[model samples]
Target chain A: MIQVGVNGYGTIGKRVADAVAAQPDMVLRGVAKRSPNHEAESAVKREYDLYAADPDRTDEFEAVGLPPAGTLSDLLADVDVVVDCCPAGVGAQNRDIYDAHDVRVVFQGGEDATVADASFTARTAFETARDADAVRVVSCNSTGLARLLAPVAESFGVETARVTLIRRGGDPAQTDRGPINDIVPDPVGLPSHHGPDVNTVLPGVDVDTAALKAPVTAMHTHSVNVTLETTPTADEVRRLLADESRLFLIPEGAGIDGAGALKEYAMDLGRPRGDLWENCLWGESVHVSGRDLYLFQNVHQEADVVPENVDAIRAMATDTAAAESMATTDQALGVGLESRLDTDTELPDSITADD
Target chain B: MIQVGVNGYGTIGKRVADAVAAQPDMVLRGVAKRSPNHEAESAVKREYDLYAADPDRTDEFEAVGLPPAGTLSDLLADVDVVVDCCPAGVGAQNRDIYDAHDVRVVFQGGEDATVADASFTARTAFETARDADAVRVVSCNSTGLARLLAPVAESFGVETARVTLIRRGGDPAQTDRGPINDIVPDPVGLPSHHGPDVNTVLPGVDVDTAALKAPVTAMHTHSVNVTLETTPTADEVRRLLADESRLFLIPEGAGIDGAGALKEYAMDLGRPRGDLWENCLWGESVHVSGRDLYLFQNVHQEADVVPENVDAIRAMATDTAAAESMATTDQALGVGLESRLDTDTELPDSITADD
Candidate 1:
């Protein structure tokens, strides 16, 4: 079994640790946290042995009625793959830590692609990451865009893709961010970093992204417009995405109103953390007027990458192909099942060809 | 002042009557309703004279503490123009009523193009509807689509347009409709009739629409993709949409999440019925890659068509020029002010042409 240690116990790290634990072929060795705070306490409560990232802060855990399993150095020695879920920039600082231990490492989106051997979106970048020493899973936006675009690229051949990401102000637990009641060009740039990040997975796909952070904290919704090399019917586009297990086409008749309702629906479905691990695509929204395909989809920022981390863990520690690893991760996580987010399968009249 | 009467005191009809009353150059003579429901009582409460759509059901008004001012035929006699906001197909049935009275008529989008002398989207079809005996305003979807497309077609020239309408199941007060948890093709076909309806206003414009009815009740969002004859930058696309009074480019700082928060924002702004009369375009969403332009925009179902109906009334009842009518209607209804929806005006680095 592959021993996976998560080197950050925040939103993504905690989930990644849980996901690694859930994988049949993997074992959650421990998770590292900088402080003995509530999250660290929760990690202890969940029975995950905690390792202090800062060796000097080992006493902080003991002071809080909890004891550290060991320093992060101990984690590096025991774990086969260390998933670095450090806050932005910190992962880069900790790069030498993993290298010194000679432990294969997996970094979350926070780290730049340069921090790893390859940027990974399991569906597209898995093969490239196999046996790689350091792999960085692309950000939520990249993962979402890559998952949806890869299928289209494989089937119809995409000429270009334009996606607008309406991002949430902060994570559900992140009370610190936002213009509160405003949207701003994130990172203050055009074709924000997300588009180029997507290219890290799909390599040469022509994609440009316009991004704005909304005031809400639910998830990021991508309004996608794709120009395909071939002019396909709407039905053809629907079947292509529907066949991909990660792209959950939200069918008509589902009581989901918007992201707000989608969250509630996930909670009602008893999803852990009300997570939408797969891309939530609107089936009825999928349209092909001619050579263009238009649709709106959402990516759960914290949870979508959990399974990718699981697959990346397997890729680093085992010889399983990306597809096989993805299938196993998906099955273990109860994903890729007939989606409850969109239950109806009937096609709209505008998409149906006149037979 | 031109005399105007509205038929069917439902969602679109009620708003049209209020819009007519708000116009300085137009007078609301009365509104007709078949049943003396709460809406008919509201007409009385708002000091709007209520007329019996069915002359034989005059007592129904008296039973609900609503006194009928007169019959619909009496309304047609007194009013110079009738805005028929009757349900779909019912406006077509009422075609004979307007013809018998020889009164110029305005029909809402529910009626087909054949129901009137010209199909109307004030921004695009006002000239064609000018002084016509009858003008049919396109559907909420058509009106929204036409308003956005006309500007693009005028400035950049559109080659083809594809729109996917994520529609609300029914109006907030419309409780009888829906699968409640289901999204269904309204007509069970591809290239929904909405695209054709848009063509009625902007004739010869190559456009096709895909439609789905979600369980939402607030507003309709259009996922739009258009191939323009000229290639433009994201900045050019933003500036183009920003300049249009009917298109409110929602910038990043506004903090509006989806239609829910958008409605709340409108209500907080003290708009009547918490309505957003203009299309809420995401400023950060406007993207231009090569010859294609993509964006996500919302058309407030009840409020968007109000000002358009006012313009149509002036187009038929008086010799007011289309531009004059639009300016007047936009001014009086507070339709086209600097949208409080998107507050920021800075350009993103991607779209900003200069370093």
Candidate 2:
């Protein structure tokens, strides 16, 4: 089994650590935390070896009754690969430490593209990271965009794409960040960085994006409009997207109105942490006007990337094919099946009394 | 001077009555109310001849120390034209009343396009309603879309348009309507009626629309992406849009992030009731990738149609040209100047010490 070490046990790290532990082909060696906080204690309680991310804070962990397995360097030495989940710029700073230990590294989307050997999204470019030393998974938004566009690009040639992201102000736990009672055009400038970042994985697929922050914490919603080389009926496109394992086509009769209902549905399904690993796209919102396609999808910022992290770990450490690896990750994590079963029952009955 | 009567003294009726009173060539003959309420009292205090909309409620007006001048039929007989500002279906029911009086009529967007002789937006298809017996202004969202697309269609031929409307749950006073903590894919259906609505004013313009309701009361924000037949630079399109009097291209230096700030800016400018008569589009969000044009604009539902109602009145009652009528309405009601004066002073000084 490939041994895995997760560094930085915050919002993303803790989820990654749990996902790593769940994968049958991988063994969770440990998780690193800088401070001896509740997450560290939770990590220890879950039987994950807790390592002190900061060498200076090693003694602090022991003082808080949560003694470290060792320093981050010690944990890195033991594991075959490490998933660095530190906040944005901090991952770039930790690159040297990862290089010194000579372990395969998986970096989150926050770092610049130059920090890794290749930018990664499993469905888009899994082979690019195969047996590579390091690869960066694109941001949640980029992953969501690339996953939906990949099949469209393959079926009907993509001429151009324009997207407007109605983003959540913050995660549920983040209280300080806001536009609490407002909608702010983040960057308020032409072509937000999302387009360029998407290019890292998608190469030459033309995309321009603008984003605004709304007073929401559930998920980020994307209003996507793409021009295709050939026109496809809305039903044909809907069927094509439904075939994607990572895209959840929300049905009409389910009565799931918004992110609030989506979250409630996930919780009701007994999903761990109420996570949504797939893009929750409204099935009815899919439409075609001539050669243009329009739809809206909600991307759960916290959980969409968890399965990707698992797939990335396999891409670097194992010689498994992309499709097989993706299947393993989806099945082991219960990605798409639960949502289908629930929404299937909620669908309307076609054969009524009159029929 | 042309005498105008306003029926239904509510959110829109009161505003239309005031706008009519401010016009250089029009006179507010009276306003009709169904019952004696605070709004009726306010209208009487402002010296507007208050008439009872429901003949049964005429005695109720005097019972509350607010006597009505006459019934709605009496006010209709006195005025040369009447602006129907009642709720959605009520205006359609009142179509026969206007026909009976033989007076020209202007209907708000809530009424269907068939309720009048022609659908109207001052910037688009003004001639279609010229000297007609009746005209209906398109909805606020349609007005904003038609106004912005008219110039774009004129300068660069529009091939197709896709828009996503981030709609407010309700107007400020509408406490009963909501998706208060949710982002609902309103209608959750393919091609929401907005695209078809725009076609009323701007026929044969290939457009598709999707909408979601956010927990906001300030305004509706639209993410517009249009494909043009000819390629134009972003600056060229910006310059073209800037020339349109009704489109307020919000400058970069002004820190108006979202609808809340836009409202605050409007109130600060001392606009009547903080009404944004112009489409407040972010100047910097104008972007061009190949032949595609993208921008974001906020539409104030309460007031964007007020000026359109005025122009519709002119279209049906006078021989004034579209441009001349729009300019008169803008000048008398102060449509676009206040925003410019305030943002001009807030702009950054480029000629600094380094220069």
Q: What CAPRI class is candidate 2?
A: incorrect
lDDT measured at residue A117 in model 2 versus the true structure, 0 to 100? 96
Distance from true position, residue B126, model 2, in Å? 74
TM-score of chain B of 1: 0.93
* Lowest-sum lDDT 10-residue window in model 1 chain B: B346-355
Please give, for residues A1-355, the per-residue lDDT of candidate 2 as tens digits: 9999999886678788888998999999999887664446557767889998889868766665678889999999998899988888788899999999999999999888888999899999899998689999899999999999999999988999999999888665444468777899997998899988888999889999998898776689999999999999999998899999999998654546678557645643446766789999998899999999999999998888888989999999989999999999999889983222222222211110000
Clashing residue pairs for model 2: none
Per-residue lDDT tens digits for candidate 2, residues B41-93, read: 56775789999988987876776567789999999999999998887768888
Tens digits of lDDT, candidate 1, A179-221: 4767877867787888888999998899998988886566888
Instruction: Give each model a TM-score.
Output: 0.50, 0.50
User: What docking grade applies to model 1?
Assistant: incorrect
Per-residue C-alpha lDDT of model 1 across residues B1-355, encoded as one tens digit per residue: 8988988876677778888888898889999888764345557767888899999888755654567889999999998899888777788899898999988998877766788889887888888876589988887778888889998999899899998888887665444557466777776788888878888888878998888888766788889999999998889888888888888877564445567656644543436766789999877788888898999999888778888888888877777888888889888888763532233322211100000
